[model samples]
Target: MRDPDLTQIDPSRHLLIAGPTASGKSALALAVARAQGGLVVNADALQVWSCWRVLTARPTTADEAMAPHALYGHVAPGRSYSVGDWLREVQELTGRRLIVVGGTGLYLTALTRGLARIPPTPPDLRAAADARLRQEGGLEGMVRDLDDATRARIDLQNPARVQRAWEVLQATGRGIADWQAETPPPLMAPDDCQRVLITTDRDWLADRIAMRFRAMLDWGALDEVRAMLPVWDPQAQWAKAIGAPELVEHLQGRLTLPEATERAIISSRQYAKSQRIWFRGRMKDWHLWRAGNAGVHPLPES
Candidate 1:
């Protein structure tokens, strides 16, 4: 698809660029930033980690030099970061012309739809939930107990989602969905922003995902993962970068380089597929740009 002429949009409106991985989201955001001044904020869940640059496909140093960027690679691997944490950070930046971009659907949902001000789960409760997720027939067992409202609200196939719902239900005696229903006004209501969803054909995105993984290797992803081995905790949020574990497995001699590369590529494709599904479901009102395909057009000026 042809690239959307994103620069033509009203400069005063906040821009939101969301898409699957490897879908030129960063580049488009940079274009919008240069043409229409704004602070380019990071909304990707993984890109916040300081330990990953290549594997997470973070904006290059050169890219950051060209625009004012915020919230990328600022968190240490050990810090506990959540959608709430990200929401608070973004809340502070609402006064500025903002160009928020990422593939993380949860972050965008929290920003535009309003997130529940749910209390933090206690450490003991969190630990117990984590333990149960690992020991008691896995997340599938836990999924069976979530309230019907939360089951309808969250992706049950995701272990992290299921575990979080379980913890909320166990600790608060109320479903996460109940909390979400009571959410206050959003930081950026959809009507106030110019949102763009970049949709790519599956085969095109698959090829790009493979190429980007190889590019990450060429740009020293392995070296980065190697430095992480001494302090790596697979359970940490930072460790969830798409290719980090596969590359770490390779460095640990658990898999050959070729095997790791293939596995990582496959994982990335799967992640992109999930991202596409999520954006499609949640962003029905956003402007749809058929990226990596032909025939893009300019939106009529409002």
Candidate 2:
């Protein structure tokens, strides 16, 4: 019998495949695109940067050759690309059927549930926030002092999010939560698209994460990082990619190869765990598919 989840998805509509990193989401997206003759649009945040292809595990050359891919490695490393920017770019693409795939929850949420139209923070406010962040040495206190509600809602551990909220509060005299209350309509309504969430046993996923990092190292991830070392800026979004910081530490002699590899793997696992938590909290209704099974077998034609 056809899989119940697949049976519910209409091939004619847009398809969204989301999961934690190294969960085989890309392969499944490729297979769906090949079978349905649809465009594969990237939703991963890091995969948009032109640098660090291997480190990001972006689509391989052979995979791109098989199907039309959009938004992969399209941005310069020095630039910061946000979910808003990605949404704007995606809006410009025209396709009858698009297979959107990635592990970025914010991108997926923006596509389906809409995003806040928060204006760009003023430079002075941004500088002030940066100064305070540097002075305070962390955003937890600053965010709490500025907006208690936002501080409670946002991940305090993520300095970027905390600083962003603080900046918004400073620039517009309103909390980020308040701005989010006035969100625009989603590009694609929930009922209009076929959404799938790939999940697997934690042990199985951990193994895949470790294997993928090893393969990335073998495939010249270090070389890619080395090339970008001269221009890498810690504040840039691409620089914050999981492997980038760890590898930079290695290149600077602060960490040995093995140490960097272990650190990157541990970070990847932690990130995957966080993604799983986000999926459970925000995308619980999306159809669930166990890794390996859905990608290897073709769904019965509707």
In order, candidate lDDTs are 0.84, 0.83
Q: Best-fitting candidate, measured by lDDT?
A: 1
Q: Candidate 1's residue-wise lDDT over 1-302, tens digit each?
A: 35547544678889888898888788778777877789999999999999888778888887889999999999997878999999899879989999999999999988999889888889899888877887858788888898998988888878998998898898899999998889999889877898888888789778778877887888899999999999988887899999889999999999999999999999989998888788878889988776743233221000
Candidate 1's displacement at residue 64, Å, is: 0.8
Using all chains and alpha carbons, the TM-scores for the candidates as numbered come to 0.93, 0.92
- Model 2: weakest 10-residue lDDT segment is 293-302
Q: What value does the lDDT take at residue 154 in candidate 2?
A: 84
User: What C-alpha lDDT, on a 0 to 100 scale, does residue 176 get in candidate 1?
Assistant: 93
